[model samples]
Target: MNLKEQLMQDMKEAMKAKQSDRLGTIRQLRSAIKNKEIEARQELDDNGILGVISTAVKQRREAAQMYSDNGRPELAAKEDAELAVLQQYLPAQLSEAEVRDIVAAVIAETGATSMKDMGKVMPQVMAKTKGSADGKIVNQLVRELLAG
Candidate 1:
């Protein structure tokens, strides 16, 4: 099943199982996806849906960090829980080695000889990683590889 269909199935299961927290998170995700579709005036394919989920995950991580820094562990824990739920829809994350290899390959393909070519390299790396790798990790790897 596609992501939207999978999410709807999970939502129904959450409701049937009386999983209030999971249900709420799934509903919020569905709402966000709907909003994105409306705003774009088009139905999102899997890649588009993944982009939305990625954005939500990033927001949750930032919110959780802010809550922790503000001494609000309860709120931070809630954000973490939601983040976990959202992450279930994402592809398996890339290992550090995998990300490094991909970044190196991208640099080679783009002929990026120095840090100056970061702009040219990053997009190709991101495309190859396909949301499996974190942007910060990929950027750091690219910089390290290119700097030397």
Candidate 2:
């Protein structure tokens, strides 16, 4: 089954198990997906759904960091929980080492010997990593690789 089908099944299981936290997170995700569909006037495939989920995850991570920084552990914990739930649907994340390796390969492939070649290297690295790697990390790796 596809990601949406898997989400529906998980939502049902969450309901059956009386896992309110999990159920609520799933409902919120579904609502976000529905909103995107309405806004776009098209059904999203797995990749599009992933983009939405990825956005949600990024938001949660940022919110959690802000809350933690502002001395709000309880709220930070809640955001962290939601982030964990959202990440369940994302593809496994690549380690920094793995991302660095990909950046290195792209740099080599594109002959990016200097920062000016960054424009040439980043898109290729991001394309190869897709949503599996965080863009910020990839970017940092690219810059580091190019600068040194």
Candidate 3:
């Protein structure tokens, strides 16, 4: 099934199992997807849906970090839980080694000898990895590879 269909099925299962937290997270995700669709004035394909989910995951990670830093473990835990739920919808993440390999290939392909070539390299790397790898990690790896 597609991501949206999978999400709908999971939502129904959550409701039947009386999983309130899971249900709430799924509903929130659906709402966000709907909002994005409205904003774009078109139906989102899997890639677009992945973008929305990725943004939500990033927001939750930031919120969790902020809550933890501010001495709010309970809030942090809630955010973490939601993050875990959201992550279930994402494609399996690329390992650091896999990301590094892709970054290396991009750097080589782009002839990116210095950090100045970051702009040239980033898009290619991001395109190759699709939504499987985190952008920040890919950027960091590219920087490290190019700087040295």
> Of the candidates shown, which would achieve the greatest TM-score relative to the real structure?
3
- Model 3 misplaced stretches (Cα beyond 4 Å): none
Q: Write the residue-wise lDDT of candidate 2 on 10-109 in tens digits.
A: 9999999999999999999999999999999999999989988988998999999999999999999999999999999999999999999999999988
C-alpha positional error of residue 49 in candidate 3 after TM-score superposition, expressed in Å: 0.6
**lDDT tens digits by residue: candidate 1, 52-130:** 8888898999999999999999999999999999999999999999999988888888899999999999999988887
Superior candidate under lDDT, 2 versus 3? 3
What's the distance in Å from true for residue 111, model 3? 1.0
Backbone clash pairs for candidate 2 read none
Q: Judged by TM-score relative to the true structure, which candidate is superior, 2 or 3?
A: 3
Weakest ten-residue segment in model 1 by summed lDDT: 127-136
What's the candidate order when arranged by decreasing lDDT? 3, 2, 1
Q: After superposition, how far is residue 130 of candidate 3 from its true place, in Å?
A: 2.3
The lowest-lDDT stretch of 10 consecutive residues in candidate 2 is 126-135
In model 2, the runs with Cα more than 4 Å from the true position are none
Assess candidate 3 and give its TM-score to the true structure.
0.96
